[model samples]
Target: MKATATMVLFPELQSENDTIASQLLLLPQNITKNPCENDRTCNKDSVNINVVWLDSTSHSHFYRSMPKTVQILRDIKESGSLNVFSYNLMQSLKGGTYVNTVAFTSGKIFSRSYLQSKKRGIGNLFNLFQNGGYHVSMIDDLCWTWSAANCACGIPTFMGVKTQSWISEVVLGKRVTIPELWGNFSKELKLRGLNDIGASLANCEIMKANGITDPFFTGKSKVAICYNGLYQTDYLMSSLELLQSQLNRANRPHFSYLDINLGHESTGRRIQTLDVSLAKFMSFLGRQNNTLTFMFGDHGNKYGTFVQKSKESKIEMAHPVLFVLASNDVATKLGRDWMRALDINQNRLVNILDLRQTVLSLAPNVDVESFPINAKYDNHPNGLFHPISRKRSCDSMGIAPEAGKCICYQGRVLQRVSNQTGVVVLANFALGELNNKIQEQFLAANGNESSGFGNCRYLIGSWITNVQQTVSQNITITEMDIHIPAGTGAPQSEDVFSVTIQVGSNIPALSTNIKLVHHERISTYAVYDDCRDVGVDGDLCVCSATPTLQSWHIDPPTIFGYISTVINLTRYLYIYERRTPHGLNLETSCDSADKTFEVVMRITSKVNVGYSKKYPLTFKVKHGTIFFIDVFYQLNPKLNWDVKYDVDFKQL
Candidate 1:
């Protein structure tokens, strides 16, 4: 028998108020006859569904033109219906468009690449259903792939669907096979496979095969029959109508899940046709007097420019839309404490685990009293039914500051507040004692080379750059661009910096491969300013040296914007001041004739942000700005040095 879930679909576009008011008339009102009074097919608490996630709809994408959806909101406001609240969802840093390292993992010291590979052990979120004898089914959609088929591995597969490894079975500790009996699933059962079949007719067949009370549905199929219908308008609309007709017949609690794609592609807009159709479905379900519903948005704007604008903007994208609706009996059966908490938290910080716990509480067979008080992934141990503290910190919730978003009032965002860390900027010479430390690290890395420390000496040079600062107690983090400078005021976009080394007819862009990462040993309290070409008469030209400067203390830099990973050291070479005959011939242009008597190699690396003992240093920073320095070195194998490049930089 085809499955007819108690949960119904009300998928709509993002909020578009005007469109909602006009387009709602287009929604179908299928429940014209009242079965409640005559057929005895419905009652006051037949279904206890706590979730109804409409494919890709989030608050940011909620369309105003959907009449049915808008009407439901209006009805809730007018009737003071079962308790509903606003929830905040966390975001992966850098939004859904760019695949960065901070998307899934949440520790401080981590690379997103290596961390994602270790999340394969999936767990059972449906053990309660197995004990309660309730059937769980899913329509073909993207969510089955992300939330189930792949078991939250962050969709790393090429098809953006199942990892084809039976991951759900592994996690749930039970079978989660598809309805297809044998062989590979036909392309017909996948997304866009609807062809011309009505969703209702298809579901009726499943109902015949699997009786309402059948244990494990015989084959333990996961009801993953309908594939990727979210992309098609008619298919989704038809599916909604068909599902509603059956739900109107539903007399027991069951689970149905589906996902829809709006084709936003991160453009920050929604389809008008979808809004009305979903609203209609939602409106129909809103009229039901025997059901409970939970509605929410997944991670927002998986692809878009709005995702990277600012921290607040990132939070906006991560923040999802959430709502809960129940009939009078269902609401009352939920008990007194849950009702009180729901009434108090109209707008509160929420995580998905809380919702999962609530679903478990509704199951009849599962021992709710034995349910674990805390979940590994929850913001708190208790579910939404319990009163979660309004003052929970993101850190305790295991949310990485970079990948987390929480609710806050004006002047309340903790990132804007200072951490009470003090940093004092000092002259380049202030760290002269560090020269020994630098030599130790350089020798350790290259000492094994044929001509290593004997020819290559450590260059202890530094330059001061600009840091975005606000006089107000709060610090507004700004973007750290990837521009590098060869000399003072001469910023270049080229990341692969190289100085040509004239070797026969070959003029390769060979500059010593030197990468600067943040050094934990170097304190942010002291920073050296970049040197400039100041004429020391015709006999000698002097580069601008460090002056006694006041150090400005600031707060930690958030990754959304501030990240000064690379600094300019071109001026430290003192080549900008030396005439044709005075210093090493250095050309800023890549096309210039090759003439390098010293170091030559290419350097490539990303800017380092967090500083801890776990990772190696690639650059040094002060007051939240990375320093750049240039020091000349000889390419000769001989240990004797003709030009003390390290000393020259030290003198500057």
Candidate 2:
């Protein structure tokens, strides 16, 4: 017998229009007729094809009414090779209850509540799948949507699928074993093979090979299961279109199936429309002899919409969903029996747990008893009506079944709303701080006062003080005034002025040397009557009596000289007076007035090293009247550091 293959399509957020369009495209061009399609005998006698579609919007309904679905799947699995495909539409929706909770609470110091709630939901789903014996696969829509954003979490929705994969590895008998019936007595073991021979052969193979290939490789029978994480409407539409294209193409296999989760509320309504449209498309595909198809939502929405106020309220919003199946061969085999079994009029409640039973029952030569069955439904009143009726009893406000149109509890509703309110507040706070800093920096660098200077030059210098102060403290210096002298008439009316500005500790360093140049004035007249009538003797007179002189100061002066006296001192501060390579260098200058004044100042200014604390040093004027001074220094050792990583897999 040929092995059965299953293809599962997990639509994250699919709408009815999207599903219908997809179905139209997926419909097969040919059809074949066969009787007893639903009958177990007919299915087993002929080649069988089975497909399962699971959607998130129908999940609750499926779970509540799982017995019939399970029985049908079991029949398919038992009769022929089983092929299964599943999908989740909610995975594609922009936001889910758990996802929004994660987003809102992320990075918040007091937001464990949202995380805990999401974990709980995921944990419940995990438990449900693990208890069932279905092999699960997942494709996340969130990962696809934000592929360029580099989200920390790889995939966001259907985490239960990943957990189930892990569990399947442990529980599914993936190991080769010698049956107890083939038990080896000492004599039989010796007769079959020498123990050393088996061990030696294994050792030689291991030594020759790099590694063992995966034993689970199913070849062409590969089954892909996925869940749409947080997909947009357009994405869901495109995805369905892709699926339809694949199904219609003759070159590809016809037996593939799809499973999807249509999320709650709007997503659920959208999936329902998809189901109806896909049904028509499946009817077309049924024309093809080798094709089989099925689609359904996994669970229904508890709330009327995808967006909910709180996790607790969402719990109350759960509902049951619907499933549809189409297969030409299977329907003909069972004939009336198949119709009787699938009759929606019978009203059945089901859950995902029945999948194992359904698949096992469809496998060839497999006894139904061989697989475990926790529950089954066959027209039982309590079974069919109990869960659904109970769910419908509550209204939109989630009042108790007995409340029946009573005044809604405002407190309860408000509390739920409050739970999500914090997210908005925190987002606003972060944005506000970011805007404030941006505005402050813009004003300081480009305001009215600094505009006319063309470009304000930054003075870079460092000073080490024994005092320990917070970064908030402001540093100011009293000396070091650079001014344009009064009698120089040096463009005084132009907004240019000579003022002493102190370089603060917070100022960044510079790399190149700086020079200051002083231009002597020819006359002291503000502006001659005709503007150009000053003679040479008048210029001399301006230079002597008026002493139209100017001074310039350049610290760490390698390119420009610093002015010593304020006599007729019209000072101009010229930054970037010269350029040199990057590093720290010291310059010495001395002057005498019956005493030598020697200054040893560190010239540590970096063009690119903006505002750093690690490069702080002291500037001192020592040994007055010395022509030159010797200086010694070292690079800060704290600047160069490294970190290490250690891993111990054994502990794990």
Candidate 1, 117-182: lDDT as tens digits: 443222333334433433343343222222221122222221122333443443355565554311
Evaluated against the true structure, the overall lDDT of model 1 is 0.34
How far residue 269's Cα lies from its native spot in candidate 1, in Å, is 1.6
Candidate closest to the true structure, highest TM-score: 1
Clashes of 2: 109
CA error at residue 437 for candidate 1, angstroms: 26
Off by over 4 Å in 1: 1-46, 54-58, 63-68, 80-84, 88-122, 140-234, 247-250, 308-312, 368-382, 402-405, 409-652
Residue 77 of model 1 has an lDDT of 48
Cα-based lDDT at residue 649, candidate 1? 19
lDDT of 1 at 53: 51
Question: Pairing residues by index, what is the TM-score of model 2?
Answer: 0.27
- Candidate with top lDDT is 1
For 529-640, candidate 2 gives per-residue lDDT tens digits of 1221122111111111221111123333221122122211112211111111211122222221122222223324322221111223322221111111111111122343
**C-alpha lDDT values of all predictions:** 0.34, 0.25
